[model samples]
Target: MREQASYLRIADDLRRRIAGQKWASGEQLPSRAALAREFGVSGAIIRRAQEALITDGVLEGRAGSGTYVAEQRKRCRMVRFQATGQAGAGYRGPDLGVLGEGETWEGRSDVMTPAPAEIAARLGVDEGAYCVRTAYEHLVDDKPVYLTTSWEPYDVTKGSLVVLPDGGPLAGAGVVRRMAELGISVTRTQERSEPGTTNAEEANLLGVQRGTPCTRIERTFYSDDGRAVETADIIVPSVLCEIVYELPVSRS
Candidate 1:
């Protein structure tokens, strides 16, 4: 066990070195044999340390190439339900905090799709019910940061200009504003978040390795009548973002 402990210590030291900028982003790391010699450890120990860094997203390996320092990932802040007074072209803009500035979002909306069972349950609608779904990818400096999928019951939005989230005069006006146009007032929202691992699709979208740690959030918007106006799933890489929730305190 002592030998195992030594490799972990070596890994921690290597991480510190990387954080200290001993090797710049995209710069190839020293060979395993070299690292082993420098650390007075076996090549296996050096390999294990490098593998740990690769999994943590601090380093990346290229086919037919050596491992290199990964590009610095921006730490985006995802604020839940905190209106930013910001409007985008095709979706309700999020309270991205510091990341809001200079950030660009691209999205696609599809109407009259059958709602999946999980989405139906969240919206309190029958399984296979038609709904409008929109998928969004948020980017910073032209790099994908996060992805979101939102669903709204078709019965409520059918035949309305706002049925397509990215269409009509109120395009991207947000759920609250769009619902208000139909005399529905969104009074509250609920969100649940948990840790998750990236799948192949998510990995490709976010430019991270499969099994990378990520944050999964489920959010639902409720009207004054307690009807679910919209529900969405948000996926963000844990290494690149943090989720913050601010709750109001009641004064009796």
Candidate 2:
């Protein structure tokens, strides 16, 4: 069996303490040395514990200031598949119940881009094969909510008006319809999601702490003929949005 680390044990205790109102939201925590003495551990261990909390969004660390309890936030629900129901638009905005139809997104697509090893594998293309790469930032009232980077194999859409995921006759038109215009019917999509931490660039884009908790989704669209037409990586900040998948239920 895998064992929990020393700092993780302390972090659990700290979480309990916060739940009991040991420090109110936005309230600074004790110094590292003080917490170390209280826990009978070294200062370094205390620092690790606090850092873990910060990464989990329970604590905030200021450059010169000490750690503090993070303020509680009401995260909005983001439902998948709802975006596909939208009509006329090439790019489908998210289905945030709170944001409603007010959400706006902008994207830039680059043609003939070389696919990285990871993305190429998802698209079933060789490394460095040409593909169309597009990046999107979804927002509500100008506040960034989430980000997506998509890759589509060039050979699939080449010579077609839908080559550019965001810049064709069906611009903003999602992958399924765009491929349909090229006689390629998208049959299904597969997604794998897991918890992650925001890096420096993602932190800046989402306006959150460097190590803030996030949801990372690796999604791919498949054609009826068993070909991967497009793949994307989506990043959602945990503090601002909650990821919920609404699977279809058969009433029969």
Candidate 3:
């Protein structure tokens, strides 16, 4: 068997100390150099240990300030009802809360954005095709919790009442109802979710450590003819919410 890395050993010890109340929640930790000297390990090892803890939500980094214990966060349960004709049958409920309660969001739309390769492929459109992209910031008590960016092929709803997702007579009515306004019937929804680390943009927008852990959800809405009408990326910070999917059994 191979020996464990020095950083993992250090990380384990750090967890023990935190568990034992050596470092209380929201309290800053000693400097990397100081910890390295005390542990008789290299600064790089200490840095790695702290980074691992940060990713696990056990600790957090402050820009130019240093590392600190993460505060206890009440992770909201973001539920996705997979069964048809059920209540809250959407990726995100009206509000982020478990029962669709207190939460607000801000949305902005860009109608002239060109679809990148991946997005174009998802929308079944050519690369550089014009698309309406909308970005949303979901917040609780004015504190940002998550984000959603949506892209729909321009040709699908151009020159219609639903051109701008956040605009139009049916504004904020949701994709299904909006498409229904355009005489388009949306039949199915697909999603794929994975764990990932936050990038610089996400970190800055979410007000978290640069390397904080997050859940990335790729979602697409399709019509009866099997055409993808819209696709979106949902970014949920790990410390803010827990995603739950309720899948009903098929009685076929």
Candidate 4:
């Protein structure tokens, strides 16, 4: 038990070190023999530490080149919304307090524009229909976490909204919540987050280099009547967020 505990501690410590930039992404971790010497343990202990990091998506061990820090990608943990009988009931509005002061809505100066042909087709709108576009950058601890743009039919939102107050309508809250009051409920949410690179504009906003690893999230929201109402393109920094999922095993 003591040996296992020590190995876990070593793995956790190494994880923090990588996250802290002591060992940058794509860089190799110390050799098992070296790490074993550093931790005053056997090579097997160091091997166990590497295994833990691999399981956690922090490091990858190549066949011969050694263990390298994995590209920073946030892992998603599964969070199942309980069937509290509220799945179909209208979603409650999240208080502005829940969004906090960390992220603010900096107003946009540009007018809303129509989406590309592909997007227009998906939204069941004509390519020429006026769409209100709102852009936002969410910051955490003064660092940008996501750069996003949301589009809605101009005929729907009345007009483009900018600079909503903290916790105010459209503040901190995702588009799904904002439209709930308008009788627009999200009957379905499709999210596909994958490894991607930052574009020139996104890199400028995120203070990162173009082509930096990022997670692109595109979500389309639908009204209760099953009509698509809004679409959002969210760009998340790979280093900061993680996705988590849990599975229930059946016992027969």
The positional error of residue 208 in candidate 1, measured at the CA in angstroms, is: 1.4
Better of 2 and 3 by TM-score: 3
Q: Which ten residues in a row have the lowest lDDT in candidate 4?
A: 91-100
Q: Kindly list the per-residue Cα lDDT of model 2 for residues 114-200, writing each as its tens digit.
A: 999999889999999999898888776666778889998999989988787768577766787788898888887888989998898
- Give a tens-digit lDDT track for model 3, residues 1-252: 112388898999999999999999999999999999998988988998998888676898889999999887566766666633344454333222242456667788999799999999999999999999999888776777888899998898888888887776766667877888888988898888899989988887876777778999898889999999999998998878778877778899
Instruction: Give me the runs in candidate 4 sitting further than 4 Å from their true place.
Output: 1-111, 159-173, 245-252
The worst-scoring run of ten residues by lDDT in candidate 2 lies at: 90-99
Model 2 ranges off by over 4 Å? 1-74, 82-91, 94-99
Please give the lDDT score at residue 73 for candidate 1. Answer: 73
Pairing residues by index, what is the TM-score of model 4? 0.52
Score candidate 2 by TM-score against the native: 0.67
Best by TM-score: 1
How many residue pairs collide in each prediction? 0, 4, 0, 11
- Candidates sorted by TM-score, best first: 1, 3, 2, 4
How would the candidate models be sorted by lDDT, starting from the highest?
Answer: 3, 1, 2, 4
Candidate 4 structure quality by residue, lDDT tens digits, 7-102: 999998998898789999889888899999999998998899898777556787688789998765333221223221133343332211112234
Query: How accurate locally, in lDDT, is each candidate?
Result: 0.80, 0.79, 0.81, 0.63
TM-scores, all candidates, are 0.70, 0.67, 0.68, 0.52
